[model samples]
Target: MSAFVDTLRAEWTKFRTIRGWVIGTVAIVGVIVAFGLMPGMQGSCGKNGPGSECSLPVGPGGEEVTDTFTFLHQALTGDGEVIARVAGMTGIATGEDPDKPNHTVEPWAKAGLIIRAATDQGSSYAAVMVTGGHGVRMQYDYTHDVAGSPDGVTAAVPRWLRLTRAGDTVTAAESVDGDRWTTVGTARLRGLPPTVEVGLFATSPQHSEELHTGLMSGAMGGPTQVTGTFDHLAARDGWTGAAWHPDVIGHADGPANGAPGAEGPPAPASGVEQVGDAMRLTGSGDIAPAVSGSGGLGVSITQTLVGTFVGLILAVVVGTVFVTAEYRRGLVRTTFAASPGRLRVLAAKATVVGGVMFVTGLAAAAATVVFGQRVLRGNGVYVHSAPAGTEVRVVVGTAVLLAVAAILGLGLGALLRRGVTAVTTAVLVIVLPYLLAMTVLTGDAARWLLRVSPAAAFALQQASPEYPQVANLYTPADGYFPLAPWAGFAVLTAWAAVALAAAAVTQRRRDA
Candidate 1:
């Protein structure tokens, strides 16, 4: 351990003595900051900007959302549950949803049940329902959702839905026969009143063309309106079995009381009707990511980290040259002579490079999250940040990304023993693949590229993800990574480990 300490000190001294390398590190951080903050700085989102025309609703933590659906609900005043067997669920899209102009049904259209604070926009809520092609899901508020079943809407197979409330906690469940039940998920609404609105609902978001337009342009959003038919309505304790009433949320033109919608008068439940023991509910709207990638909220530094590759690429160059330059200068012989352990020398170099890059990355990410939102807001952009813990993860995850990249660079440098060749290799394998995936590749192709490329680690910085409950094309082009955030980071880490292992073996076996 003491010998390793001395080796680390020696490596650190070597790295810091070079003014050009130190300057390069600074420049790398500068590149990340400048590029990260530059893209969304001018997006319109104040009173008349891109997202200002229709002020999307906000959820529990002020998360930006679009909630404009027709609802059919009844009042429930205490702890109990509601169960309904849905005979079938289907929908149609009008010219557009809630406030937008549209006609037709989106593929991801939905119909289900929800328990909400009231018939007001931005209220806390939870629901269990069936979607167009995505299967069963439990969605809450405007931000959280989870899948329950892989089987989606089918005429042949009817589905059962249930929501149970105990104090502030709400649990959603689903069943096929109404005898055997499976838990879908659960959520808690803080300070939820004993009395709440509970009932059936349906909605559809912008389909292919309109969604594409909204996502690509980020300035206009007139989603496809949806109508769904439901049946087999039933309820358990706590519900008075009173007649259900239709309420609107997210009207586009006025203030909402229990009246309906966000900005306008009550939504037209043109498709809702009751037949025998079943009721059909049709509604339009969405509760998911906004077109601007901010979810109509402010832009987060995490999502903006896409541009950090510029800094990371420069770090790769610096790291590669750190060791390859020594080889080019014919200094490896002296290094091995002094240490005798080639592995220790490599470890020392890796430690120095990795440590410095980690600090640089951590600091850069910190500054971006801390102040990037302010810059966006100054320019009329509204960003919704994650909880404190997620913020910490973004900052630390960014540092880990840079540190691993630096180690990978050092390994390549030692293996190739040529500064230009090592740098080129690192950039080609890491930076170039990421750029292609983000820009030129199609959805399926982009996913494959990101899965294998070291750039997959970028998922660690994702603040926005596509929800299956919401209608939108969930692809890499839409800012959703194919792999989970940690999974993507692990893929890159695996690549770095393999490269380092090969470098160690070659350094030990070959002459300096």
Candidate 2:
């Protein structure tokens, strides 16, 4: 054990003594910070400049979310219930020419009955709604969504929705005939007050469709407005406040309740109108988690770490050279002579290189994430704030990712015995797939590449989650991954472990 420790110490000494390797490692941090803080990544947010700002509403769970909708509400006190029949839903989508638009309802457009803590955006709420395509659903707080009947509503076949509140629990139910109801789901909005807003709401998120031009791909979308017809609206038990009041929550023209940093320009006028026995509500925007794409405010913390790829290249090169340089200089024979166990020598080299890269990556990633967000905001960009835990994982996961890549590079260096060849192979297998997955490939081709390739490990940097309930583009370009963070890290760890094992066997069977 002491000899192995001595071997480890010697390897560390040799690594630091090599000025080129040390410089390369330092360059990793420099490149990561430089690319992360690069200028011209600005946004229209806070156009007034540095101190100006734009921000999204933070939900009950502290996640940035979209809470815009046209609400026709009445305040309810204590335990109560609100019921409404969604008679119909319709909407229009933007076309190439502003003069001509398509009359169509986006699949996720919602018209529902909600029991909210208040009219304020991002307040705790539970709702039962009929969607344009997803049928009936019970959604709450931005992230929680539960599906009901797989059926759309129409004037002739309306869907009846109900929300009953008792203490902190809100139960949602749906019915086909309004006579018999089936429980859809329930949500516990802890600490909900006695006085809450019970209302009918209508909202439509941005309408987007994949745009494929040959090998390249993108999304083309624009704001859309949806109108829902509701009849037989009734409130039972503990109802208060004046008659139904119409207000646009999270209006783009101004912040909710005079809060600063409104999201965008005024959307199409959203309001409620009495049409005979039914109320028609027209609204634009969404009541869902904010994600990165055509629908989101701007980018996520993952955007600040875009330089990880470049830093990874530098780290890989340094790791490869750490081992291959010794072989090229005929120092491996001396290393093996001193530490007769070839495996221990390889282990020592791996530990030294991995540890150095880990520390370097940790510093670079932490600086990039911490200061890069400031740079983004300084340039008038709205960066979604990640939860503290997610931020820590992304920062630490980034370090681990770089460390594993470096170790993998070391193994390749030992096997190939050529720095250029090993570095090229490492980049090809790790980085090229990521670039291709993000740009050239599309659909399953892109997802499969990310799923199987070493690039899958980059999932570690994905700070924003992909919620099944939110209808947004969940693509690699948007910083979403097919694999979970730790799962993706495990893939790279497995690859490195296999490579080191192969190098060990090759080292023992052949001359040093």
Candidate 3:
């Protein structure tokens, strides 16, 4: 143990002194900080709520309500495609002026509503469409000719929408900047169900460059900023509102899908409303609701961070070079000579690499949160805060997985000896399963593949609602194989262990 510790110290010293390593660390930190500081690509909506006054009409059902309302009185609008599919539901469409032969716009498969404003020429348009269950849509087209100038035009005109819930309530509101909002009217909603999708969206219609576009260009062109805050809202229990509720929907899922015995309960009243899922508000309007839900932000960020780390380990220094260097330099003899005990040496290297990777992973994950949040915020992806403990687990678990990845690299390197062979093998291990799952898995097959993949282990970073069994994809209609987070991690750890054991046995009996 003492010798192992000493070797670890030596390895750490070697790591820090390497110019490449130092540069890499600094580069990572810099990227993280830069991402953290990026301003809103569109416009600042302020921290949390307390912005503009925009009103949302309640329906008649008394069963639905709008959780968030952002009003843009400035009238930055444009035309584009709309998304209208519920969870697991799929389809496609386009938005073009068929009558205008030369001016027809391409159809964009976006969630809902697109407000594009040309910053240069000051031309803009905002349009919203319904695509999901009980969807509604409204649009306002304005030109400087109407109000004289874009700025002055929005100031004089107030856009209003009447939202009627499932036959119980109605709400009306107006806005100037799409940020500050004011209620225009509110009536009890009527004749609606218990759940709905609520969020903001915008897109562009023109591919031409002759016009000057403002914040609307981004929203319309590719990634647009869509934001809204949920407050000053009232709801009737008899009807469901489009409020964000992690507890009610986060865990709402079915069985283990094709698992032999996994059988999930039926979907809840809302019928599985995820961020990207198309949702209907009031009676005829629809919303894609930015992909921001319960722990949706955290889950998305964590997934991205883990994926980044996986890419780094496979593409960057240590993971790529560990085994190859040993083979190329003929250092196997010396490595074995110094330790004599092959397994002990493997253990030592694994500890050192895993520890460093683990610590760095924590830093990377925290950076991911910071930068990811900034990106999400800039793009109007609401990043909700996670509970304290869950946040900690997210970081710790990510780091641990990183460490495992590194350890796996070290073990595989030792076993294969040829750095190229080992690195290739490692990359295959990390990437192959996901590819297979994407292409090969069907009903029951998905469970087995998902259970053993890194993707499955990473799912642990997700803070499952208290009742995850309610509405998640992992718990499908049939329940045969569903490994919990730690359980999945254990499976991965076992893989590492077996690999290490194999390396040890091979090293002891081989020529090196």
Candidate 4:
């Protein structure tokens, strides 16, 4: 143990004595800071809400979302059911003007039944809807979504949608012939209100650039106003045959989504109501990346850790050189002569390189999340933060990712016995896969890549996640990692561990 400590000290001395590597490691903090701040500058925000309110989200554990849609709701006291039969769910999806021939309906465009909390902006709710393509689905809270039916929604045919609430549990089912119903799924809400709003919802996202701000900021689309025709609408118990109240929610979905006749809402956009039969509702917002049944956007932390790539590249170079430089300078003999146990030498190097990388990454990631959010706010790009604990995990988890990756790079260098080749291979294994997963791959393929590649660990840095239970487009392009954070990081750690084992074996078997 003393000898191992001595070797670690020696490795540390070597790292500190080198100017280029030290500088590069130090520069990681600057890279993270700069990159993290860039997104704030690029963001275009400050859209006015209802009554001259242009508010930025400030909370923990909630999504920085714009969930606008139309609802024809009636109040329900205690556990009850909201059921409706759909005649058709159709809407225009056009990149050009609505009048253009290019417009058409999207397969995912939805019209359905919803049960929600009173607050329109951010609420805990469950929905069963007919999609433009995916048939029928059950969405609850925000992020949890499940496929209810495989049959596609059509105008000629009508499908019955039912949402039965029993205390905290909501059961969703769909019927082709109204009597024979197939259970979609059940949602368990923790703090469901005895009296809640039950309604039929029809919404179509612009599905275009009108509301799209950026990939990280989430779906900012206009309400394409899907007029879903419903003839049979019934509520169970709490029996008041009151005419449904028509409300358009998620007004903050975007500017283009709400500006009518050129007169802006001027305040933060709120729900627009037009109540009548056929209950026409025009809104485009989503309940995805779900809200906790007890509401509040804990702290809106932007998930973008801009400096991850640059910092990893630096870690790779420094880590590779930590081992390869010894071979280049013919110093392996001296290192072996001093330590005798080559594994000790390798362990020392791994400790030094991995430790340095962890510290550097932790600092960079922490600063980026902490100070970067402030910078974003100063630039009028309020970054919605997550909970303090979650933020801490992200900041720390980033460091862990870098440390493991550095160790992987060091092992590869020792195994391959060359800096350039090792660095290239490390980057290919660690960084390239992340880039490809994020940019080039399809959602499914990206998921597979992240699942298998060493870079799958990048999921650890994702502060925002798309829940499968939610109705949002859960695509790789929208920052959704196929794996959970720690689980994904574990995969990378496995790769690193294997690489280190191989390096240890090769070091024992071969000459310097």
Candidate 5:
């Protein structure tokens, strides 16, 4: 053990004494911080002159959320229930021809029954709704979603939705006919007040389609409006309000509930109209988690770490040279003479390289995430907020990712015995795949590359989660990954471990 420590100390001394390696490591931090604070990265969020601040509503779980819709509601006191039959739903989307809009409904358009703590956006709420193409679903607090049925609604086959609140628990039920009901899902909204707003709501998120033209790709979308016809309205127990009130929550014309300037064109006027027992509601915008990409704010914290790829290249080159330089200079003889166990010498080199890169990456990533957010916000960009735990994982995982990559490069250096070849191979396998996945590929092709390649470790910097319930682009460019953060890290670590093992065997069997 003492000899191994001595070997590690010697390797550390050699690494520090090399002026080029020290400068290269320092370059990593410099590039990360420089790229993160780039002056060209500007936003129009709070640039609405003055008194217009950019912000997003925080949901019950403290996640940034979009809470915009049209509601026809009445006040409910104590335990109560609200029931409505969604007779029909329809919408329109933007088309290539400005004069001729496409008559269609977005897949995520929602019409439903909701019990909310207040009329204010981001307040606690539970809803059971029928989507345009998703059938029936129960969602709450802008995040949780539960599927109820796979059946669309029509005038002849209207879907009956019910929301019953008892204490803090809200139960959602759906029915084909008014008489037969199936319990869909239940949500517990802790701290729910005695009196809340019970309503029928209609909303549609921005409609977007991915546009691919050779290597260049973009999203084209526009504001969409959805109208829902509700009939068979009924209420039971502790209904207080005498008449239903109409409200366009998070109005598109104003800076409320959504990021400033995020609302493209003003949606068609949203309101509610009643004729006898039936009510028609028209609304636009989403009641879901805020994601990056089309219809979302600006970006996520991941944007600040764009320099990581460049930093990784430098780290790989340094790691490769650390081992291959010794072989090129015939210094391996001296290393093996001092520590006869070839595997021990290799281990010490890996530890020194990995530890140095880990510390460098940790400092760079931490500084970028912490101060870069302030820089982005100062530039009027609305970066989505992440949980403290998620932020912590991103910081630590980035360090681990860089450390493992350096170790992998070290192994490749030992195996190849040439710095230039090892660096090229490492970059091709690790960095090239990521660039192609982000710029050249799309959909499953891009996703598969990130899933299988060493570049998958980049998922560690993803601070935002992919929500199946939210209608947004879940692509690598948007910071969403096919694999979880730790799972992706594991893939890169496995590659490094295998490379190290192969190098060990080769070292024992062949000449130094």
Candidate 6:
């Protein structure tokens, strides 16, 4: 017992004398925290950007309009080759979706509403009509010709949308709801019209004059509920609107809430009148801004706690070096002479080092949890809600694993004796597989590699309701096997067991 006590004292003194280990541990923690805080880091909690905005109806026919903050645009495709275009001042010109390039459609081929209103009273424009200066617009030229009677009166209710071309004529009919359809007045003009602009019109007779427009050159813009349905042009037309389905354009058809569809109302009216122009059509006030939820304080605390636990486990390198340093200095022989029984010396050193790592891990984890929670609260990510007792169990579990990992290092150090060899072997056993997975394997293979690495032990930090991307990967969402927190720990513990057993056998047989 006395010899064991002497061994413990010696181990404590040597560990305290080392400074490099402390620096390494601090560096790792600092790097991880800094990475998490980077502006667009996956877990970073911040306002992504401006929320979607939209202009309301101006008047009955909805000709005059107001400019909205909504960034809406158009996508058209179909026919021979794929094309992309945006609806704007000149007309539908080739445009690209910055966020989803695959959503691009061919110009004048098929028409699409890049943005729609959740309510009704919006207009739908066909592709291939990009000329006329007024009303819902599209651009097209008639190679063939036809003649229609000059007289077609629009319904007094301001419902019929009329197109005037000689031979080829296209009409879009809208009823009170999408389930029914009615023909507005047909265009009975004289000669064939060349490429023309076609667009829906919203007029605000009570408030303003200038038209408002929506620009869809960027991300998913415009109001969500406005849906645009299209009809086919002809048997052998350039754009049938069927080849490139609405689904291909990334739009789902639904009702509109009076917000301008596609490119919005005419450009903002000049000056002070604009305020009234925008406010003339009162909104339902039902629309809610998109809100990103912040995690609870408890979750942040949990992450920090776990991080600190892992940090302390890594701290065991100091103990390994401390023990081996004495041998390198030729003082271990004196230690053995003083201690006598080898087992007593090993037990004393293991107890002191293991106890220090365990206690330090617990404290560090607690401090990390507090600090991390505070930081996450400021950003908006929250922790999962669990009973107070469960939270305590989690905290204790994490710290215990870290404590065990540190002790495993001590056993390994005893068996190897040489500082560099043992430390390198320990680190390689835990780290090399993960690095190899980066290039040598992919998909399922990589997942298995992760399970075997020290990093897998961190799975204890995960909870249900994870981010969509993460949940898809780590859970049964896609038929992949999920290793629950404890299961993951068991895998890590098994590795530690193999290491510890090897160490014990070596220590028992090898000379001091």
Candidate achieving the largest lDDT: 5
- What 10-residue stretch in candidate 5 is worst by lDDT? 94-103
Model 1 lDDT, full chain set: 0.73
Clashes of 2: 0
Return the lDDT, model 1, position 114: 86
- Compose the digit string of candidate 4's lDDT tens values, residues 312-333: 8888888888999899899999
* Candidate with better TM-score, 1 vs 5: 5
Deviation from native of the Cα of residue 212 in model 5, angstroms: 3.1
> Which candidate would rank higher by TM-score, 5 or 6?
5
Please report how far candidate 6 places residue 297 from its true position, in Å. 16
- State TM-scores per candidate: 0.78, 0.93, 0.48, 0.81, 0.95, 0.44
Each prediction's whole-model lDDT (CA):
0.73, 0.85, 0.40, 0.70, 0.86, 0.38
lDDT of 3 by residue, 273-351 (tens): 2233233221101211211122111123443343443333432346435444656788657766765666666666677
Ranked by lDDT, the better of candidates 2 and 6 is 2
Model 2 scores a TM of 0.93
Candidate 5, after superposition: displacement of residue 53 in Å? 0.7
- Model 2, position 51, has a per-residue lDDT of 50
Model 6 alpha-carbon drift over 4 Å, by segment = 1-6, 17-316, 380-394, 434-441, 465-471, 475-482
Model 6: lDDT of residue 25? 45
lDDT per residue, candidate 5, 351-419, as tens digits?
Answer: 999999999999998999999998988887778888888888888888888889999999999999987
lDDT against true structure, model 4: 0.70
Sort by lDDT, best first: what order? Answer: 5, 2, 1, 4, 3, 6
Task: Give per-residue CA lDDT, model 2, range 450-491, as digits (tens).
Answer: 888888899999988888777677888878899999888888
Model number with the top TM-score: 5
Give me the runs in candidate 2 sitting further than 4 Å from their true place: 49-52, 95-102, 212-217, 237-242, 254-266
User: Residue 178 deviation, candidate 6, in Å?
Assistant: 29
lDDT of 3 at 199: 28
RMSD of 4: 5.5
| Each candidate structure's count of clashing pairs | 32, 0, 109, 43, 0, 63
